[model samples]
Structures are given as C-alpha cells and as structure tokens.
Target: MSNPAVSNPAASSRRAARAAVAAPPPRPTSAQASPRPVAALSTRVPLGRRVAKKAFPPAVMLAVASLLVGTSVPANALFDPDAPPASMALSSIADAKVAETVEVEGQVIEAEAASDIATTAASRDAWTVTSYAEMLRLRYGSTNYSYNASGTGPIRWPFPFAAPVTSGFGDRVAPCRGCSSYHRGVDFDAGYGAPVGAIADGIVTAVGRSSSFGYRVEIEHIINGQKVMSLYAHLIDNSSVLTVGAPVVAGEIVGAVGDTGLSTGPHLHLEIHVDSVPVDPFAWLVANAG
Candidate 1:
C-alpha cells in the first residue's frame, strides 16, 4: 500500500493532507484549557433575565434559598427548605402531634359569669333595643295611656307592659289623610314587632286581609253570658294561626303589631263588638279584664 503512494510526490502530499484532515487534535492540559462562554447575549436583554440565565456558585444559590425561606415563612406556613422539592401539606394528620390545648385531657375550665345585669335607663334601652317614653309623649301627650287597670277574668292584655293608647273608640279628629273621623277601634302604640296575644280563650272565626281592617283576626267568645267578638287589626300578614276553627288560648301570641291598614305607624287596633255593637275597648277592658 505504501509502495506506490510513498514513491509518488503528488500522491504522498495528497496522503499527508488526508491524514491531517482525518486525525483528531491532541488533548489540551488543565493549564492550557479555557472556560467556555455560556451563551452570546444581546445588550437589549433585561439585566435580571441575563443574570438569571447565567450559572451561580453554590454559596450564592444557598444564600438565595436562605433569603427565600426567611421571607416566605410568615407568608406561607407550609414552606420548608430542607425537604426535597420544598414544603407541601403532609399526607396524613397523624404525621404531626396534636397540641395540648386542642386535645383536652381533663379538668375543663369554665368561662366567667356576667358581672352586673343592671345598667342606666338609656344604656339598658339601647342594649335591649327598647324605646317608648319619647314616642309616647310625641304621639299621645304623655307616656301613660290607661291600659294599666286589672280585672279578674280569664283574659289577658296583648302586651305584658302597660302600652300607650293613641286613639279611643267613638269619635276623633282624623289621624291620617284617608282615615275615618268615626273611629271604631282602640289603637295601642305597642312597639313594632311587639307580640299581640289573644284577649281570651276562644275559637278563631275569621283570618284574612281587608282594606278596612288590613290583616285582622276575629275570635268569638262567651264572656259574662254575652256574645263578645274581639277583632285584632293592623297585624302583620304572616299570622301564626291561619285555620278558622283553631282554638286559641288566652295570652298566646296570635299576631305581631304592624302598620298595614289606614294607620299612621306600628300599632294594634283592637275592636270589641258586643252583640254586633262596637264598644269602647278602654271602658270594656277596664270593666272586664283584671
């Protein structure tokens, strides 16, 4: 193989060139070797991005991780720097020990009782959400409205306290624009949503809404060997007892005080009819109720 190629000068030169092209260069020593550039970056690239792309030393990376952990600990409770891939929720609740307070053993500590129940009149009313003196004075001149008299019957007043009466039965100056001058019922200025109870134990005769009465309930009872009909008007529409023949006992909450009919404000318009004749409730309740 060498005989013809070695002898010819042109062929020899061609063989030497081929050998140089085919053979790899000698390996460089550690001293001779130079570090390679990571990438060729443009000046237009963001400084932060360029820095992020470049490799960092172990100490610098460790410092960065430490800073992240310190800052994120408060913001993220589950953050963990030691565990692989950082912190995440544990697989099971049994992985962590329960707190002494959370898992109570024995001897439960009871809370302290309230100190004092009594307070100032204004504070007491504010706390209980009850107000009346001012409203009564402005509406009916004084706070007293004359429902305080007691009688010895199975009947009970609608309100537990002495409620203010705005108008009496018979005749009065029209209270509202469309109100009747000849008033037939007694208006009790019980506060809004105040419970209205049945006057006596009786059977409900009527339960409906009308323009004249506006959400009223009528009950029939035999009082003192006389047929007395009691009508509770200006009541909230959602009355508890709706059945006609429902037997109601005295002092049971039948309806709530409201402003539904031809009225001015929240009150209960109670009308008592003795043998179909309208009578003054004040005179009757004073005479009958004990």
Candidate 2:
C-alpha cells in the first residue's frame, strides 16, 4: 500500500497539479515586479485644491465680517434721537440771525417811508398857502387881510347912529398931510361924539393910535368860514369902552366918532379886511350887511 503512491506517476502528477492550483502566489523579486502603483503628485494637487475650496469660503466670510465691523458708522453720528446734528444746529442759529436782520431792515424802511410821506404833505400845504396868497394879491390888489367871527350869516351895519357916507373906499388924492395916496377905508360923517358900534360879532384885536387915523380899534370876525377884520379909526379921545380880546356883538357900542389923526372933520373911518387884505368897506357892507 505504501509502494502504490510511488509506483503510479500519473496519479502523482495529478496530485501535484491540484496542489499547485491550491497554493498562494509567490512573492516577486524587486526587479521582476512593477513598482507599487504610486499615488500621483497631481492627484495630491486635486486634493489640496478641494481642501482649499472648502476652506476659502469660510476665510472670506470671516474677513468680510471683520471689515464690516471696522468700517461701520455709528448710529449717533447721523441719526441721534436725543440730539440734533451739528450742521442742523448751526443752520438754525444762522436762520435766527437772518430773521432778526430782516426785521430791523423792515422797521427802518417803514420809518423812512413815514418820514417821506410827512415831508410830501408839508410841501403840499406850503404850496397851497403860497398859491392862496398870490391869488389874494391879484384879486384884492393888497395883501393886508384879517380874520374875525362874524355871526353865522351876513354882517351888520357898524354905526349905532344912522349917518350918511362921507368918504368911499378906493384910490384918491391925498386928503390930509399924513393920508395915503389911495384911500383904504370909508368915512361916515357921524358928527362929534356919535356912538360907534361893532359891525358884527367879533373879538377886539387891537386898540391903539395911528399916525394916519387916530385912535383905531380892530375886531376880527368869521362869516361862512371866511375871516374878516373890522377897523374903526379917528375915534374921540378916551372913547373906547372895550379892551383887546373882549367879545362884542353886532351893534354893540365900541367908541365915539371924532376927528383924530389925518381927519379934516369929525367922522368915523371904517375899513374891512379879508384875510389881511383891505377891501372896499362900502361894497362889503352893501353885499353882506343884514
């Protein structure tokens, strides 16, 4: 039985073939086996690129967050709820100053305007007065006028004693040594010591002596808003019963007619003035006497 294993070659060969198929592969020599497939350096490059790709986004995000924190503006600098901005505060002060300046300028302008208006009004008034004066000179041929209060309507006859007219008002040859070339008043031959009365309601303005007409009395009257003056001259000595500023009514006795300065005989010299200009007493009496 032991010799049977050695004596059959074909069987032995078959066993050998089976063992060879069942055995593991032999270790290779250094020269005979290809080097172990080395991982390529390029492959490591892809891995590095992948790692960088994953880390890069986080790094960029962190850097951006830091930049935002560093460059961020403070809320108080632009929009503070408790306090105004510096520029706004300065603007408010500037506006206040401008308003004050405007107010002052407006006041000055108003004052100047008021002054101009007053000046214009005064100039107009002066011109009116001058024109009125010129008109009186042209119409009356004289500038002597007077103001008086003659009752509401027409004037009254001046004499207390009825007398005829002795002399009329107008130009005439010199009647006496001291008489004017042009007669300015009318004369009534009332005889000596005749009672002289006021022509209208008036206040005595003057009581004095004159070289031309002795012992004169002047009374002022207003009639129809016009001023008038009455004159009584050549009065008797110590005959005046009224003083200056005394009120007198029409027909009230003022003095007595007599021969005084510049008179040829005993008479009453009467004159009328409109706004200081002498007018014809006879004409005035004829037109205005009640």
Candidate 3:
C-alpha cells in the first residue's frame, strides 16, 4: 500500500541492496615462508672402495709380475763368456847359433864341443845341464848358471814316440802322477821286430827278462876313461842276437824293437849310464861326436 508521505523530515530513504562477493584464492604453498634445514646422509661403501684402491694399487700386480720374471732366469748364463782359453803354451826354439846348449822342455839341447882345428883334438868339458833330484842346473863350459840367466843342453825329445833313438839318456817322465821320476832313457819308436843296433862299442853285462823292463839287455862301455853302461828295454820276443859276454860296435844291430813292459806302444827304450849313473844321451852324443 501506498502511504502518503507526510512530513518530510526524517526520510526513509529507500535504496537497492546488492549481494557481497569473496576475495581471490591464495597459492597451494606459502610463498614467503622460511625453508627448513635438511639432514646429511652418508654413502660409506663407495668411499671405502676408493680408499682400498689407493692403498693396494694395480701397480703391485705389475711389481709381482716383474719379480717372477727375474727369478726364472738361470745363474750360469751370467758368466759363460769368461772361460780360459784352451790352447796350450809351448816354448819356441829360435836360431841357437851362438849358445853351446839350451834347455827345451826341461832337457838339454846341446851342440858338439869345440874342437881344436890344429890337431882335431876335442875338448870334453864344454857344456851340460846338471840333472839332480831337487833342482836343474845348467852348466856352460866351466861356468855353471841357470836358465833365467843363460845356459845350454843337448837336443832331446820331450814327448815319447815310436822311433829308433840311439841315445837313451835323460828323459823326464813321471812314473807316478805326483812323483817326479824321470825316464832315464831315450825311447825309439822303432816298429816291432825292427833292428835295435848298438849306439857305441860296449860289452854285454846283463841280459834277462825283467818284470818291469820285459826282455832287458845291459851293455858296459868306456868313455873318456869313465865307465858308461847302456840298457835296452822291451826287446823283440825270443830274438837273441848277442850273448852276455859279447862285444858290440856302434850302430851294430843287437836286438829287435817290441812293446813288452811299462810301455804304451811299440818302442825301444834305451838308457845310458856313466859309472852306472844315468846321463842325458843327447848330451853324450854331442860330447863324443858332433
């Protein structure tokens, strides 16, 4: 109903009323809030593996491989090139024109004694090497000396061979390995059954079969008013050419050569003795004849 507006003072003002709307929505998380501190989580297995690799390195395997290779080498391979040379040393004989005699292989190599041209008389006292038990002394003329100074002797074969050597004198040979016993004779490597003649005129003294010397024969001769004896060893079997009392001349065939006793091969072992003492046959040959 319409009511009449009366007296106007207070007026009931009539206005249109509108519905209230909400503000805009906020974000899902707070944008301006302080962040929280995170807790630390340790990974120990990877760190331990790294530390083990550093402590026991792959280089240890390489070192072990090198040591194994070094131990496998042989010891003898180190010094095989240092062995001694095999060639033997021998003393050389030069042109010995001036010297009366010289030593070769511990025996005297001598020439003939000086002869007087006026009467052809020979001087027996020329040169010799003293053969003794302890030492060897070389004597030249009347003067005696040693090898290191100067000396001489007769030409003698040092080694044994198969031949006819007339003079049997001083041959230095060891009967035993350590003992210094000489072969008091010159051996002739004359073939078996070859004729062994007398080197000088001598009388047969002993002829018999011996255990050490086989069929042996002894001859006694005179030289420069001195008695010299000759011994023949290892004669031909059963071939008798002389009796014990028979006299033989130089170069007279007396026996045959054979290998009978204390011999390695077929040869004639001849020995010459002065007053029953052994002397170098080569020296004797030079002194008696040129």
- Lowest lDDT 10-mer window, candidate 3? 144-153
Tens-place lDDT per residue, model 1, 1-290, is 56875578898888889999999999999999997665654336887987777746766889999998988778657756666431222211212222322355541221111111122222454554334544443554433455573422497776777888888775556778889877788889979888888888889998878796788889998888888899999898876565789988877777899888887888999999998899977778877776
Stretches of candidate 2 off by over 4 Å are: 1-154, 160-162
Q: Candidate 2's residue-wise lDDT over 130-162, tens digit each?
A: 565355446545423232324234366666334
Score each candidate by Cα lDDT: 0.73, 0.76, 0.57
Q: Kindly list the per-residue Cα lDDT of model 3 for residues 80-125, writing each as its tens digit.
A: 5665432211101122321334333332423222112211322233
Which of 1 and 3 is ahead in lDDT? 1
Candidate 3 stretches with Cα past 4 Å from truth are 1-180
Backbone clashes in model 3: 18
The lowest-lDDT stretch of 10 consecutive residues in candidate 1 is 110-119
TM-score per candidate, in order? 0.49, 0.46, 0.41
> Which portions of model 1 miss their true places by more than 4 Å?
1-144, 149-153
Q: State, as a TM-score between 0 and 1, how close model 1 is to the true structure.
A: 0.49
